[model samples]
Each structure stands twice: as structure tokens, then as C-alpha cells.
Target: MKTLTLLMTMSLLLAFVWERVDMVRLGYRIERLKSDKVRLERERDELRVKVSSLTSPARIAKVATEKLGMVPPRQDQVVVVRLEPEAPSPTSLAEFEIKLAKHDVSRKVR
Candidate 1:
């Protein structure tokens, strides 16, 4: 009876120690993940700032003029075009009006 009780006590002690070890390991993992999250967020912010700077109109214009030798178009060289749908021809309009909401029915109404 004494040996059985001692065995149970040792088993319980071992289980408690294993649980405490696992908890400590999990705490370390959580800290590592938190640090990684912060580092990645900071990196993302830096990349966002870089992207905004790279895409800024001023930077783009400067690079275009300096690197690619591009120049702004003169007012005379620039033309604005407006697109409008073509109007139906008079003959087609007359044909459509002649057809005037006609639909086929199976039988004539009384």
C-alpha cells in the first residue's frame, strides 16, 4: 500500500513539473511571436513610407526629366478629345418609328 501511494505521488509530481515546463516554453514562444510581430509591423511601415516617396509626383517628374529626358507637352501640342455616341440615321429612325412598339400575340383580344 505504501509503495503504491509513493508511486502515485511521484507521478503527480512529474505531471506538475511537466506542465510547468510546458508553460514556460509556451511563454517564451509567445514573447518571440510578439517581437516578430513588432519587427514586421515596423518593416511594413518603413516600406509604406518608401513606396509613397517612390511614387510621389515630384519624384516621378524629376526622374522623367532627368533620367529619361522627358519634357512637358506644350499647350499647343496638347489636345483634349471628347467622345460621343453616333446618332441614328434619319432612315433608321423612321423605320423604328414605323415599327412603334408592335409585339406578336397568340390571339386577338375581344
Candidate 2:
């Protein structure tokens, strides 16, 4: 009976220590994840700032004129093309108009 009680006590202590070790390991993993999350968030913020700077109008215009040789159209060089009216038949224009009306109605409803 004494041997059995000793064995039970040892088993309980072992189980408790195993649980504590598992908790410590899980806590370490959680800390690592939090550190990684903070690093990634900082990187994301830096990238967002970089993107905004690159997409600024002055930068875009400068790059277009310098690197791509793109220039603004002069008033005399610009020619406007007028599209002919589509037929009343079920054409793409009519379909687009129907979709637009549906969108407008949805917007109004909202």
C-alpha cells in the first residue's frame, strides 16, 4: 500500500511538471509571434509610405517626361473622337445602361 501511494504521488508531480513545461514552450512561441507581428507591421508601414511617395503626382509626371518621354498633349495636337449612337436593339450599350440604372437604384436605396 505504501509503494502504491508513493507511485501515485510521483505520477502527479510528473504530470504537473509536464504541464508547466508545455505552458512555458507555448508562452515562448507566443512571444516570438508577437515580435514577428510587430516587425512585419513596421515593414508594412514603411512600404506604404514608400508607395505613397512613389505615386505622388510630381514624381509620376517627372518620371513620365524623363524616363518614358511622355508629354502633355497641346491644345492644337488634341483631336476628340465622337462615338456614334448605338441601336435600340439589345446591344452592349443597352446592357451597360441597364446595369448603370440598377447601380443607381441600389445607391439611392442605400
Query: Would you list the clashing residue pairs of candidate 2?
Result: none
Kindly report which residue stretches of model 2 are placed more than 4 angstroms away from their true locations once superposed: 82-110
lDDT of 1 by residue, 22-78 (tens): 999999999999999999999999999999999999999999988876667555555
* Candidate number of the best TM-score: 1
Candidate lDDT (C-alpha), each: 0.77, 0.76
Instruction: Give one digit per residue, the lDDT tens place, for model 2 in 48-92.
Output: 999999999999999888887666755555555544456665554
Candidate 2 — what's its lDDT?
0.76
User: What clash pairs does model 1 have?
Assistant: none
The 10-residue segment with the lowest total lDDT in model 1: 94-103
